[model samples]
Target: MSGEGDTPQAIRKLSPGRLVIASHNAGKVREIAELLGPYGIEPVSAGELDLPEPEETGTTFVANAELKALQAADLSGLPALADDSGLCVDALGGDPGIFSARWAGDAKDFDLAMRLVEDRLNEEPDMPRAAHFVCALALAWPDGHVEWFEGRVDGTLVWPPRGGNGFGYDAMFLPIGGEQTFGEMDAAAKHAISHRADAFRQLVAAVL
Candidate 1:
């Protein structure tokens, strides 16, 4: 529930040094690493360190993110940052929100996942096509101190998908008042307005 200057209590400030990115997703790791680039933080991926992916049994994004971050921090003995993000389609009643990745199945075939979303929407054509991306970021220290920040970007779902630059459901998500879908936009442009970027900004304000 932490936002800029709105934490429940005084949170520990993150000193620049080696930090772990608790995620096995390459695209996610890349995006987070890009955000940490300007800071004096050295980014390392959990997969790179051979960290086992923890079961995401949490009911909410913040809970899952905090769980991963704490696990990584404890195992690596360093500060760790974890991100739990997902696409929520309004028509689907926020389904596939926390289960976004699982929707991709075992192979993580996002193309198939996108098609499944489309098919689900087809079942209820009268439903609204509005959707959004949610990102919850958790920064945890080895001792268990943690801070969570969340961000969201509202958008519409487009059919047939577009572009191929971004990963997951980015190809079909058009940001509000935006001409290009997240997948169509370059990394720098997407980073400027993405849900992850929004949360990262809050993290920077409160802890960076």
Candidate 2:
């Protein structure tokens, strides 16, 4: 983690010439682009530029986000942004927090991963089914100056999964105040209240 974005300045303070989104995931890149759209910034993806997706060796979301941001910034000579996100369950003791992406592995077979989650949690069917989605966003310049923000959305787990709209564990997690699971919600609706959107608000206030 860069530990540099402790407090947002409450105003826009950034205007870069070009920015690199340091992620290869189409879903993540699209979400980020939508977030940055109002700011008059059209960012480019690391994949489009042939930048490498570095190994996520950090222990926490912020650390991994910072690593990706710094790597892209270094390689591309442009300010870079990265997001590390996951689904965490209380009963699972946050077992998949940092290893969320890893659990999906290179091929990203989240269907198999979600099945594993149900198998593990169903073993204790009487236990609490509380869970949440967490996101950490990192913004880094080529000089290594870094800013990071983390956000989360608490919710509960459901059985048999409900929808096929979202990737990862979206089908099984239901937010605290919402009836629809993330998978069941419409894309624009989900974007407005997602964990990633929460962190992006801080990113906007701190360094848009």
Candidate 3:
């Protein structure tokens, strides 16, 4: 298992240039753009290039992120970055990790997903509601040189949800040491202490 500062021995440094974000998700693209803003590199989305969303065949978040990045890099002949993130509830035995998107159904209805989570948990009220968000970032070059990092933030689920500032499961998750749910926090505040931010910090250290 890898932890912070534990760089993958196979990973190498990458020079900043035109990079493609391998995702159709608008929010993800925006968040990544913000993260890379300081580096002053041109960030383009796969959607912008009309790239197809590849099947997420990988079973784990890291593998899925790498798969997407490498696919986009190969298609665009440029450096590509990808992120696979999810909410893992301990009570659910880390479920909805890779299938987080699927939980939203084909309609991408996260409201239904959240309701499902609540309904399922209602069946087992004795179980803990502890959960965490996991994010895996993969950076791949056209030639297939890859660097990846994983980050996670611990928190607990709050019933009835709170706030409307974030998407997906943010409204129901209250991070450890935080007074409000992620959905209640503003962008700057959320970015300052998010799982993606942690993964970005690791990737920057490993291969910026």
Candidate 4:
């Protein structure tokens, strides 16, 4: 695997005008596109190219993000940006880290996953069921140059999910410095303080 400063032999440099976002999720793509727009880069999604999904076998967020970015760059012949994000609950011993997406099994039943989180913490009652969302972003050039950034938001989990705006664990996550859950906030509001947005800021700084 390529480490810091050691460019991959297979990758090539990204051109100046456009960028490819290595994700299939429309929500993620839209957010990233908006974030990168001010930098004057036209963002394209892997979903638009009908690219094959890359398997995320890496143990850490950085590893997974790099894996996806490299794969997308190779396939699309463009610079690719990828991110891996998940909620890590302290009460569960940081479980559901990488498995956050599969917590409710392969069906991706988020409702069941949220219920499971509640069930696991119900008995704790007074115990602090704190959690945090982590986002790791990777930017890979077709020529093998890659960089990564990480961002995290500490928060506690709410019992009954609230709001209907955001996706995943948004309804159950109350950020450390916020009064409402992410789902309770509008997209612009949530993006202003989200872990993904934090990471994206770093990405923009590096790229621009």
The numbered model that scores best in TM-score is 1
- Tens-place lDDT digits, model 3, residues 1-208: 2322455643566677799999998888998999898886799999999999999998889889988999999999999999999999888878788888899999888888888887877886577889999999988888877788898999999889899887788999999999999999998898889999999988787777
lDDT scores in order: 0.91, 0.84, 0.87, 0.82
**Can you tell me which runs of candidate 3 are displaced by over 4 Å?**
1-11
Q: Pick out the ten consecutive residues of candidate 2 with the lowest summed lDDT.
A: 4-13
RMSD of each: 2.1, 2.1, 2.5, 3.4
Question: lDDT tens string, model 1, 1-208?
Answer: 2533455332678899899999999999999999999999999999999999999999998889989999999999999999999999988989789999999999999999999999999886577889999999999889888888889999999988999998999999999999999999999999999999998998898887
**Candidate 2 has which clashing residue pairs, if any?**
none
lDDT (tens digit, per residue) of candidate 2 on 1-208: 3474355343325575678999998878988888888887769999999999898998888889999999999999988989999988888999678887777877998877778777888786587888889999888888888888888999988877888887788888888899999889988888878899899887887776
Backbone clashes in candidate 3 total 0
Ranking by lDDT: 1, 3, 2, 4
The TM-score of predicted model 2 comes to 0.92
**Weakest 10 consecutive residues of candidate 4 by summed lDDT:** 5-14
Clashing pairs in 1: none
| Global local distance difference test of model 2 | 0.84
Work out the TM-score per prediction. 0.95, 0.92, 0.94, 0.89
